[model samples]
Target: MLDSQSILNVLRPVQDPELQKSLVDLNMIRNVTVTDGHVSFTLVLTTPACPLREFIVEDCEKAVKTLPGVESVAVDVTAETPQQRSLPDRQGISGVKNIIAVTSGKGGVGKSTVAVNVAVALAQSGAKVGLIDADIYGPNAPMMLGLSAAQVKVQQSGQSEVLEPAFNFGVRLASMGFLIDPDQPVIWRGPMLNGIIRQFLYQVDWGELDYLIVDMPPGTGDAQLTLAQAVPMSGAVIVTTPQNVALMDARRGLRMFQQMQVPVLGIVENMSYFIPPDMPDKQYDIFGSGGGQRTSEELGLPLLGCIPLEMMLRQGGDRGIPIVVEYPDSASAKALTSIAQQIAARVSVLALA
Candidate 1:
């Protein structure tokens, strides 16, 4: 006879790779049954797109099979979208679970590109996602998401009026670009910048979101610092190119997040290499190579991915459809998707812990 207590004891050694917690300890084992020497149960996961799904399943089965009188093992795996377990609560934007800031040390490194696609990728995986163009001076999220002329609308949520965000590609977007003229420049001082950042968070009707990706302004400045302090950020994703100059600035960005006590999720190396259409067999080092890797090693962080320079990526952003959605099977899209998975995995692990 197979009982629940005996089954749980047998599976006590099985642990989630990311969270490092035993299945029994995490209460992931459910509906345990045994009849005629056959053992079956369900394993609840933190996220449906967990990168280590296979490993966890295999480990659970292996552990259960070790029990005596177990003829066959049947395991069903189910996942509930994990919540932001480790982050502090936001006062105004209390509906948001995870706040991720896609930032860099300097400008012109495809920070907006990375931020937009990552949000799309997470949404593609069946998670509710929102984006904020925190770069008040250069709010390109509206342009990137194909909402250049979109305007903010005021709606009554409960008692007071709230600003509504533009929606496209299944992601909610709010940016200063939609409110101001494209040709006009935002020549504002520091206090104004700070005030608008707060308004975007507190005034906007973001409703509910699993992850809110903030496309932060270039460089570490008052705006960046203010945003970090304003929200309870789950982590920060540092984007950089392989160029030495970009790496220098990227290092600063990584350290800035650490100094603020925000977890640095990982580093993404954009435009690491280029492959021309005419010569598919050969690879060119456009901005040098391994700068992201070197920086990740020095900082002791994970190098989430190395994206190559491709024409589709540039054209997709211009067309207002991110590469991840337009070219889901392309190499660039795959890299972004994998990075998103890693981010989800890290956040789920921390949340569960």
Candidate 2:
């Protein structure tokens, strides 16, 4: 017969694919029993329809079978209730009161950078805001917010409690990167991915704020679906460059939000052109111009603003300070501010109606 303790020790290395933590660490392993070289256990998944059910079951079976004298394994999976899922609940975020998701159809068009600056601009305009870095696979908000090395303090009270968000530049922020090793790759399936997102939304201690900006990963996938289902998003901002390929993806992103019933806030064209500071008259259309504007026109959404390509924008993002904060008077910074103002105005109108 397999010793229970021995079985547990063997399973210690097995981790939840999404949370990137051991089942023991997450308290997901339950009701372990052993008899006549056979083992049975219950695995409490974070969600009922866990997308990784087959993978998890296979992993559990393999882990248990490796135990001395264990011949067979039976794993029963169940999900926790929503209330049971959330730890100690904090006061809901008040004051500035809207949750917006900033997303892109594809990567590398400066989506994360745009998200950070938008949050910063909103904060600078006197609206309290929070930024949730929802891009689990590529969480760059921490680096952009100058908090790559920061950690969120997890509080407990009877049950696991709120995970306090780190603060940078007056905006409260949280990211999966803060909780995981920087170099670790997050390879998770749909269900597990959704659960992690839910955990971030319900378990985090997000205080009063006017807006909670979620930086979504590129592509219209499980992450986007989970976010749309989890939160009543105020609107979505589609970021794209003035290139055809980027615009194509941006259009898909806009359509995704629309299909999910979330309003399309507007489109912002980043790297629209290169303007020399000295010449101030010469404009270089590096990636081709007006793609974003034409897309917005076709979709019947506003073209919020166009951000000129500047070395300062890249420098600021790389240095953990948004261009808006580093050089508020710069053209790119001003453009972002204008975009923020337009969004705020639109949101206000929506609230009134």
Candidate 3:
């Protein structure tokens, strides 16, 4: 008979590509209703930014179509992000399902750029996203996120002050840039960094975020340690350039996370090559190549993606607009989006495990 039971029975063999399990078993397929000859159901994904959404839906459709009397199939798609497993000594943000740290061992590897665009891409995919500029010393996320002059408001909640984050490009941002003067430099000692990082993580009104992307300053220092010890992280993405020095730093950063018992999701190689706008057909590997892949292979971590250097990418950042939003068709933008999807997929798998 053409019923919900048969529909689910067919879909039982159709598994989530990433999780390698039945969608039905995962309880991702739900709300079945049959009418006339039409069969419809909901496909609830683990993350909104699932890279293979189309393929999963297609598989569901094909599976349902094989039923003896099914005339048509309709799958309404939705997502529910899972919470990361908490560590014994670490506390989780109340409404945040996952916390992702985007960092590097050394400076100037486009770590902030990756963090910002990844947050924007997740938001674009209908995920509730937040970004914390944990780069306390040089808080550029405000400028890059188009909130250069934006101020974060503080509201009294009980006895403590809670910060209200600035929002743009679908990603809410909490940064030292929003709290400090534009020309002023944060010259605090190492001991003082912990308070500010914790405040950014816990004292902000994140309000039910699926992913909170923390953009950490370069190096494995106080800020990185404070965060790992303070909260349960979904994973860390080490950003690097296609250079030996950057790769060396990335290794140190990855090891730090592993030692702290935080999952190192993968590595992101930015500025892998230069794609000159004037010469659309030409490519230049100014920073060298394959370093990220080699490092990932050597270290046994995933090489999430490689973003090409493009003039427009910097311009977009300077213009307070992300490449993913301003020039979605650009190569860098596409790479960033794919990396965001990969991060989300990894987070889901980790959460499920």
- Which prediction has the highest lDDT against the true structure? 3
User: How many times do residue backbones clash in model 3?
Assistant: 0
Q: Which residue ranges in model 1 land beyond 4 Å of their true spot?
A: 1-92, 156-160
lDDT of model 3, residue 9: 90
Q: Tell me the spans in candidate 2 whose CA falls farther than 4 Å from its real position.
A: 1-96, 188-191, 276-281
Per-residue lDDT of 37 in model 3: 74
Whose TM-score is greatest here? 3
TM-score of each: 0.72, 0.71, 0.75
Model 3 bad stretches (over 4 Å): 1-88
Better of 1 and 3 by lDDT: 3
lDDT of 1 by residue, 1-353 (tens): 47878889989888766434466755578889988888889987655776778888899888888878889989998864324323333453788999888888878888899999999999999999999998888888887788887777988878867889999988999888876766775675345887888888888888889999889998877666677667777888999999888767776676456534478889999998996757755679988888999989987889989888888888888889899988898778899999989988888776776
Q: State the TM-score for model 2.
A: 0.71
Candidate 2 C-alpha lDDT tens digits along 219-271: 87768867766666678888888988876677667645654456778988888
Write down the worst ten-residue block by lDDT for model 1. Answer: 81-90
* RMSD, every candidate, angstroms: 16.0, 10.5, 17.0
Error of 1 at 86 (Å): 13
- The models' CA-based lDDT, in order, is 0.81, 0.79, 0.87
Ranking by TM-score: 3, 1, 2
